[model samples]
Target: MVDKGGYRMASGEAIEKVYYDGQKATKALQALENIWVKRDLILREPKELNLSRPSNREAVMMTIVGTAAPTECKSCTKKDGPFDGCFVVPGVARGSCNNCHWNSEGIKCSFRPPSANVDDTPAPRKPTTTALFKKKAAATAMTATAAQDATTTPAQAVTMTPAPAAANVTVGNFEVLPLILPPSMTNAQKRLLIQTFQNMIIVLENSLTDMV
Candidate 1:
């Protein structure tokens, strides 16, 4: 149909269209045939990995060893088999068997058994701005505690006398400022608040120094 003069009665446009369509179909068929040939060649090639049959004695022995943890450290048996003969995958839990080196001792499987708490254990928290902030806060608290402990002592408390109530009194030319405190605040709470503020100021000063 595509010969130079085979369709002499047909229009030139019709003949050209038919000829190109036929060429496309022929190329597609050739491509399909090539794919099948390559697939066959791959299938015919000899596979090096040969897993023991599930019912075989070696396979059963491997399964037992795979399921159990290694009795001795630094020694294990090595075996290459089908994916189903070893690790757990999708529908198959192929036991704990894995490829490992062998020694004079028995087949010490190298597979590490899954941890019992694997699912319950939480992933480690990644360090972030919040983590840094928490660390700084903790440092500040520690500093405040250390300063308060160092400055206060039982001996000073025993020897110290109570001072007169805070009042506005003249100290030379300038009048003394009246000290104001919350009515409900206790001595311990007041000391804690003062220590906290001091620690915060120190932290700010250290941060500013580092920036400079």
Candidate 2:
């Protein structure tokens, strides 16, 4: 329980620790920023390092905590290397050993690269207007042909090819269409067919009676 304080920022937050003055705080803060920038890499400072004070009465305070590492690499060969932030102090949990052979964190850090932007989940696609309109147009053409067949008179309904039973229906200048059956046939076509047969029967009966 190291109790310490420094002058508060304008927001009333005391600096974490008042190391002699602001200079120490700056160094510790800068060191932390460096460690964060290089994770698993040679750290300027380790995550487990703790910079604390014993009292809060001073006008300036430092509450900086060093990043602590689990432990020093026993096989570190850079113990006598140039003194840099990456240099690790043996048996201490903060700072890192710069030697590649001794730095496990460095190997892992290579895989954890940083990025600025990320894509969100993709959205579903929609039907294009042109395709929808083409489908509708084809449907409309079929409907128009069916309707025209339903309205043809027996005189106008000339069967071009010799079919087995019923003649095909052909309009003014169009191709002959197959006849629709009674069950599946439309009401208009059915009525017209019935009327045509009835008229033909009447004419036949009257002519036969006259001849008799």
- The local lDDT score (0 to 100) that residue 11 gets in candidate 1 is 30
lDDT score at residue 58, model 2, on the 0-100 scale: 18
Tens-place lDDT per residue, model 2, 24-129, is 3444334433332222222223232222422111111111222223443432323422112223322221223333212223232221223311221234577699
TM-score of each: 0.23, 0.19
What is the clash count for each candidate, in the order shown? 0, 26
Tens-place lDDT per residue, model 1, 9-53, is 123332233233333333322322222111001111233222222
Instruction: Give the Å error, residue 173, model 2.
Output: 40
The candidate that wins on lDDT is 2
- Among all windows of 10 consecutive residues in model 1, the one with the lowest summed lDDT is 36-45
Task: Specify the highest-TM-score model's number.
Answer: 1
Which residue pairs in candidate 1 have backbone atoms (N, alpha carbon, C) closer than 3 angstroms, thus clashing? Answer: none
